[model samples]
Target: MRFSILASGSRANCVLVNSGGTYLLVDCGLSQNQIVDHLAELEVKAHDIAGVLISHEHSDHWGCVESFAKIYGLKVYLTFGSAKARDIQIDNVSIIEITPQNKIKIDDIEIFPITVPHDAKQPVQFILSDTKVSLGFLTDTGRITPFILEMYDSLDGLLLEFNYDDQMLQHGKYPNKLKKRISDGYGHLSNRESIEFLRRVNVRELKVLVVGHISDNNNTLSKVTELLCEIGGEFQKIIVQKGKKTGWLCL
Candidate 1:
């Protein structure tokens, strides 16, 4: 299986995951043209994508889904609440309603949508599994759930978030309300919180760990990486994804 993060974070979030004969995307935040460019950069085609799985209705996650689906005939799988909130209307795109805490199998992959504390109407993080390997894609949440711990034990790769540094958020130039919102339970996860989760899960086979969705203003790559390594042990490789770029990982 191969996976590449086309981009991640508040600007535009998307990930292309390919396993066996199935090609799936976690989000479609980028426009059709931008997405095409990134896929082309990785030598992948737009029509090769079979499905798009959305985490929520937030603009950074669901912005270009309708246009992309209309262009490529890809089915979008998301929660019922999120679909309603987005009000996305496009033909040839089926909506597969999935709730957190339930496992849904699509073709060759087993998807477990784990519930998370996020500000979206019904945000979910995904843990994807094939027969041999498991890849957990989780972000845009302030807290992890018990279901996550179970998946951590089996994951060969993880696309997790280290959204911010607490001190930066507290002292940065952003407004007070925005800072408070970021630190809330429903907001993005901090570097400290992410490390705590890594320690709690204690994943050993975690080969690829991408520290994703970092705040460009509030956190630096070096700071988040240093803290994560301090708690993520010394085995797993960590990569940070930024802008309209690609980070490759094999599982």
Candidate 2:
């Protein structure tokens, strides 16, 4: 399987996963033109994309899904609540509804949408497998649950959230309520929280770990790098390091 974090940040989030000749986009947050350009950079054609799986209804995750689907004639897989919350409507494109209770398959990939605690309606993260390898795509979540830990126990590749640094968040310019919301269990995960999660889950099979969705204001690359280094012993198998966006990992 080939995994690429096409774009990941506060502004937008999108991931590309290719397995057994099928190309799937985990989100369509980027504009249609931006997505098209990125696909070109990856040497993948728009028509080759089999489907798009949305994590939530947030603009940073599901913004351009309708336009992308309509333009490329690709299917979109998202929850019913997300469709309703976003009021998503596209004329001829197919929008497949998937929930935590009901999984779906596309070619060799079997997608499992696990519900997560986020502010959006019916928000979910994905665990995708192609029999031999599994890739966990998780972001835009507040806290980790037991179900989440169990589901991502053994993943070959992971795109996990490291949204912020608690110290910076507490002292940052954001209002008290906004600060509480982000640090609260219903908002995004801090770098410390993410490290704790990595400690709990099994990383025996982990090949590449991407710390994503970093806050431009509340977090810094140097801080994230330092934290990961401190917890490097936890995931002895994972080569923890600071990474830039737009790179491919083969598993």
Candidate 3:
């Protein structure tokens, strides 16, 4: 299996995953034109994508889902709450309502959606596998749950959220309310929280760790790098920047 983070951040977020030629997009936050350009950079066509799996209804995550799915005639897999929250209205696009109960199969890949603790209604993160290799795509979540720890126990690759630095957020220019919202359990994860998660999970079989959803204003790459250095793991680390794509990594 191979995947690329087309874009990741507060502004927009998307990911492209390919398992034996069956392509799937985790989210469609970018404009259609931008997604096309990024796909071209990886030599992938938009039409080749089989489906789009939406995490939640947040604009940064669900903004372009309808348009993109309509344009490509692709299926959109999301929770009922997300669909209700967005009030999706595209007639031609296939809307598959998913829950954390069962796994969905799309050609070569099997996707398992697990509920996450975000402010949005019925938000979820994904665990994808092609039988041989498995990947966990998690972001936009505030805190990791026991269910998450159970599902993500053995991953070949992980695209995780390293959204902020705790100290920086506490002292940043943002207002008190926004700061409280961000630091609260329903907001994004901090560098310290992410590190703690890494420590708790089993990384013995983890090969690639792609850190994403970094806050441009509240965190710096150097800080993320320094934190990563302290972990001292054998997994290959790729720190993603806002609006930038991490070239495809295979596992």
Candidate 4:
């Protein structure tokens, strides 16, 4: 199986996971043209995608949901509330009302829609697997919910979030309200928090841990790399994903 993070940040979030030529997209936050262009850069075509499974109704996540589905005739799986909020009822869409702990399957993938604590209504991160490997995606979450921690205890690969650095976000030039929102446990995770979570997980068997959704105004690639290095050679053995780039890894 193969996985890639097409883009990640406050601007947008999208991930591509393919196994045995069966492709799935985690989100459609970028524009249709942008998504297509990025895929082309990766030598992938639009029609190659089997479906799009959304994490929430946030525009940063579903910005191009309707357009991508309409243009490609691809199937979309989203929560009922998110569908209502976005007013997205596409003919090719598979609107699944997912529960906190429900496990469902689509085509050749097994999906576990693990609930996450975010401001959105019933937001979830995906754990996709076939017969050999399991790829877990977690981002845009408030904090490290125990459910997520337990579920991702032993993943083959993870697309995790390390949104901001405490010093940078606090000392940077931003409004007080925006600062509060970011620092809130309900917003994004700092680099420290992300590292802490990585330490708890079983990183021995994990092939890769791609850090996603970083704040450009508040964080840097060097800082993220250094933190992972501090965790010792286990995570350093894998490649890291960037905020606005494509990172592909095989498991």
Q: State which candidate has the highest TM-score.
A: 3
* lDDT for 145 (candidate 1): 62
Cα distance off (Å), candidate 4, residue 195:
0.7
| Cα displacement (Å) at residue 23, model 3 | 0.3
Candidate 1 regions with alpha-carbon error over 4 angstroms: 89-93, 232-236
Q: Candidate 3 overall Cα lDDT vs. reference?
A: 0.90
TM-score, cand. 3 vs. native: 0.96
- RMSD to the native, candidate 4? 2.2
Model 4: lowest-lDDT 10 consecutive positions? 234-243
C-alpha lDDT score of every prediction, in listed order: 0.82, 0.83, 0.90, 0.80
Name model 4 segments beyond 4 Å from true: 90-94, 235-243
Residue 114 alpha-carbon offset, candidate 3, angstroms: 0.7
List ranges where model 2 is wrong by over 4 Å: 89-93, 233-244
Cα-based lDDT at residue 173, candidate 4: 96
Off by over 4 Å in 3: 89-93
Instruction: Tell me the tens digit of each residue's lDDT in model 1 across 1-251.
Output: 77988888888889888888888899889888988988888778888887899999998898788878877877898987788787754333476788777898878888888887888888888888888888888789876667666666647888888899999999999999999888888899898888888888857777778778989899997897678657745455555556646556788
* Candidate that scores best on lDDT: 3
Per-residue lDDT tens digits of candidate 2, residues 1-251? 98877788777888899998999999887889888888888899999998899888888888688877878788999888888898865433498888774678998799999988888878889999997999997788899999899999989888888899999999999999999888788889998889899889988888778778889889988887887787654332222222234656788
lDDT by residue (tens digit), candidate 4, 163-251: 88999999999998988888787788888888889888777778777777888788988898888778874542343344456556778
Q: In terms of lDDT, which candidate is stronger, 1 or 3?
A: 3
Give the candidates in order of TM-score, highest first.
3, 2, 1, 4
